[model samples]
Target: MSRVVLRRCIVRGRIQPARTSDVRAPGPRATAPNSRDGATPRHSASHDNRSRTEVPMVSSSVGGVKSPRFFYGWVIIACVWVANFVTVSINPLVFAFFLDSMSVDLDVKRSTLVWGITIRMISGGLFAPYLGRIVDRHGTRWPGAVAGLVVGLVLIGFAFTSNIWIMFGLFFISGLTGFSIFGGNMLTMVPPASWFVAKRGRALSIATSGQLFGTATFAIAAALLIEAFGWRWAWAIFGIVAIVGVVPPYALLMRRRPEDMGLLPDGATSLPVVEVTSAVASPTPTAPVASATHREEPDFTVAEAWRTPVLWANLAATTLLMVAISPFLLFRNHYWTTLGFSPTLIAIGVALDPFSFAIANIAMGFFAERVPIRFTGVIGGVWRGFGMLPLTLGMTWPGSVVLHNVVWGIGSGTTSVFQTMMIPDYFGRTNQGAIRGSITPIMVTVSALGAPLGGYLLDAGVSYIAFFWGIFLAVTVASASFFFQKPPKHAPAATDPPTRMPTST
Candidate 1:
């Protein structure tokens, strides 16, 4: 019996080895650190359980993007687009509406009213970078929702401001609301770039239309509102309408990116939705990995974008334009009062500025592909050169004001719309947010100073009509600057038929 038991033990020992290994376990990483202790790790049981990393495959959305089937990205664009329209439309337009009331109620110098606009410009440009990084990490929906709340609350607060300082504070906050949410536009571009490589130009143009259309329509509507109700009530109306209109679409429509959905980008026929993971929310150097999906579009690094000569040239262009545009926005109260227009009519005119831009943007959208962007700049310069001349002469002559605006509106719209193309054109695909964000500060500062400068020039007994001519010359300098630089070597080319759009969510 003892011999038989020993034999059984011997048999059991033979059946099992000292250690076991599973083929499924991953091989060691090339760069993994070895412990100082220098013993090979005893593999954990769960180590082999999960797969390494997955690259999903998906070309088209589960359902093709039809009218009812807006791709998640497209939906986000539409929603953000409307919000953008309302934001820009209400900002400058509403200021023109409420200035006289604010002047009377607060008893401040109306020329100083540009101080409010100047403050907003400075604040908005400053906050852009911080907001941009958060979007890069998280997503657009939250930021947009938060911006709406801020805009609404500040607008409501405007109703009660008895002090100029308090009103100044609120207007600055309104700018934060306006420019901070621009991150949404960048967010939209990145994902759509992932989903629709073939039709990117058209998709971008469509997305851009919202901003254009909204500016015009919102301007007109804002004027009508200011006309019917006092500025106080206009604030209330703007706040209420934003909450009702904006909140829903953001929640339902916006997404982080297609990679989050485990799908390929741009829905290439061969590569499917691979997943925009937290890992992909960003990537580190050395690896330089990108998905076979949408991220393949030519992208630039922030450093590269800043280094480009064209970008610097464009910066020069933006500076001249900023100076030219600031006079109307910063000095609207002074502009109207000197002309003897009623506060009501000034409000009405403010509305026209954005409305004109909206129409101009749509028309310019067609020309974007057809014309060289450089030509647009030259045309805009010529218009800006002359756009404000009539208004500078004084508000007493409404015809000059109207004519100035006709050119002003067209030139302003053209210049702004053209500026919109800068991202895809020079920065290409990568780091556009950072590059664009970087420019805001310079632009805003020019605007900030330009406002007071306009007022100061008027105070100095300089003819604003002469100032307008100088501004036109500045535009010429800016337009000419574009010639100093060459196009980025790998800049994205305009597509022939345009790329296909991502499927609707």
Candidate 2:
């Protein structure tokens, strides 16, 4: 003979009733679900009558797993990596690969065809502010998905268009969406910044380094595709990849901020709320008191940040870098072709660039926190100047080309990492997206002129030496400017929030 009894059972912060025998003591961690499919067994008399306490069952999600064991932020990094990897293949890198073929097929001069790319660059610059504002206002998931679609469709459209005017229009639309910065670029950088403070440099570097991987893999793939199929088919294939490859990851894994995951930045347990008050003193005032308290720094408005010196300095440095690098991006393949390298060899050399970029990117991320970002820019700038000058050496030796890619890749790597880290380090993360957005147009506008300017010079019969030498001089001056850059003083003073573990919710 047995009597039934209802006992209190607490599971996943919810209290219910069960037979006293079915309950088990709470262990170090919740017990695994009893069912083979990893579901919690319903509390019932028939299932278990011998146990006297309730066993805490681990929570299961859609995939039949408990909560993620690793930091969710790294998951964000991985998703962004894939997004950049697929999206970039349709942009100018691959376009550069297809330039000569497209011009010949369309019966257009090389200089005239270059305008399509120029249009895209200018459109990206013009639209950046608006898109950046959208990112700051909205979350990244939808914009990234939509942009992926736009870029994919545009690439497919490019395959069918032979008219120069239509090419310009297609490129313009793609620039508005295909360029990562205007589309989902901010999503990748901003989310990571929101999730980390002390380790932000490393996190940002790791995420942005995805560009290197995309460049390495996609450049080789694009060259190979163009070799096997016609240029039009190459564009079509890249388009399909962009549409299929980019959107799913963001839809599933992308999180806008750490709080969404019930976590704090850098795996913090609690967010700090700091209070700053002005104390009147005759000689000097003491720093704000932030003792044993969670405090947030004062967020600067976009207008306020614009009034600072640091913003302008960053704008100038980045814009100059764009001017220096733009020509190479547009003409690197053509430059190699003229140097007597086969398309396959050129592809191999270009693929090697990312390996160099990856090394510098990771190294910079690891050390960025330890060093002044301005110095990082200086090092990158000096390296770029020398790296660019070598392409003018006219060495047909394969080693010279490889050497050029390695030096330039390593040098250019730090430039991007510094640009990203500088914004948050100088200004707090509160308005990071907006500040970066405002600075973007200035850089892109300068870069937009770079390719056309190079084309014009080439049209006038100027040698690659002339173009490379001019860029080298410009880069040297830009590198020297980093030494004069100081953190913004005009904006509201903000201190780093104290680190503390979050309280268990």
Find the candidate with the highest lDDT and give its number.
2
Work out the TM-score per prediction: 0.69, 0.79
Off by over 4 Å in 1: 1-70, 178-228, 258-296, 332-337, 340-352, 370-372, 385-401, 483-485, 490-505
lDDT (tens digit, per residue) of candidate 2 on 255-368: 777656665556543222211122222232122111112122224568877887767876886677677666667787787788788877777778777778778977888777
Model 1, 253-279: lDDT tens per residue? 676655565433333333222221122
Clash statistics: count for each candidate: 36, 14
| Per-prediction CA RMSD (Å) | 15.9, 14.5
For model 1, state the Cα shift of residue 229 in Å.
Answer: 3.9
Candidate 2 regions with alpha-carbon error over 4 angstroms: 1-69, 181-184, 271-298, 490-505
